[model samples]
Target: MSLENNKAFASVLTAGIILLASGFAATMLYHPQDLEENAFKIEVADSGAEVDAAAPAGPVIEPISALLASADIAAGEKGFKKCSACHSIESGGANKIGPALWGVVDRTRASVDGFSYSDVLNGMNSETWDYEALNEFLAKPKAYAPGTKMGFAGLKKVDQRADLIAYLRQQSDSPAALPE
Candidate 1:
């Protein structure tokens, strides 16, 4: 073919290729959801179906033996700062934002004098502040007794919770009377 004719032919071929490519690009852009829906998928088992055989029977509260043995009163005192915003640890202390925490370690949940608590805490009258109860309550205040006035997000760390309990115990009149 002549040079001009050959160039014209090549130009038409290039234009056609470009046009084809542009059409494909435009279609893909406009129909992205369709491309996503047509993607390869693999089926997996639902995570909720798996049973945790090792899960504890009751709420995972810290043990009394471990807390009494290794309980650090200093750390507990430091942890008590969080509670100090609402509670008073001094013996025979009056109630504050929440109830005074004096004698609370072995005392009942909401038995403090003249201080009104939410129905959740009041409902726990029979429950004593033993190690297990304290641990469970401190781990998740709302979970232990729903609708409690104490708005604390329970201390997740077992050791820290233990420390706070120990510090509170020390502040009580009968600190030695607390279960070992």
Candidate 2:
């Protein structure tokens, strides 16, 4: 090949290599995994089929009441470090990114003054945060309250949630009684 043809071939080869490498790197950086279930479904009006709404797919969370009796408050407090960035567990503590959780265990949901709660949570203001409620919420925040602004993905472990609840229960001046 002539010197000019050689140079041009080299440039084309380098460009082709770069293109292939970038495409491969992009795929590696963003691995698109197949979802276990459909994220959302739109029902066809004329399908004429009964569509039973199914719960989101995940392990069935066992109630944490039995776990709370023997749950380690110290470990729970340790777990709170992860939550401290968003919540304040101290009595009379000001709200951070999330509402102050000082007395959140049995407190009314979305009742914290001055802290803006999501519409979904505001709708649930009448409800109280009992042990079971906290358990479920801790396990999966989004699943419990869809469209909630709380960005925490949620603690996945049952024991971790139970312990965290135990610690939160102590943050109150008058702690709510543990579930039997």
For candidate 1, which ten residues in a row score worst on lDDT? 38-47
Off by over 4 Å in 1: 1-59, 176-180
> Which residue pairs in candidate 1 collide?
76-163
lDDT of 2 by residue, 1-180 (tens): 699999999999999999999999999899888999889874322342664569445568789999988999999999999999999888799999999999898999999999999999999999999999999989988778888898788888899999999999998989999776
Per-candidate local distance difference test: 0.79, 0.89
Give the TM-score of each candidate.
0.64, 0.71
Q: Write the per-residue lDDT of candidate 1 for residues 121-165, one digit (tens) a residue.
A: 777788878777888888988667666777788899888887877
Cα RMSDs, all models: 13.2, 7.4
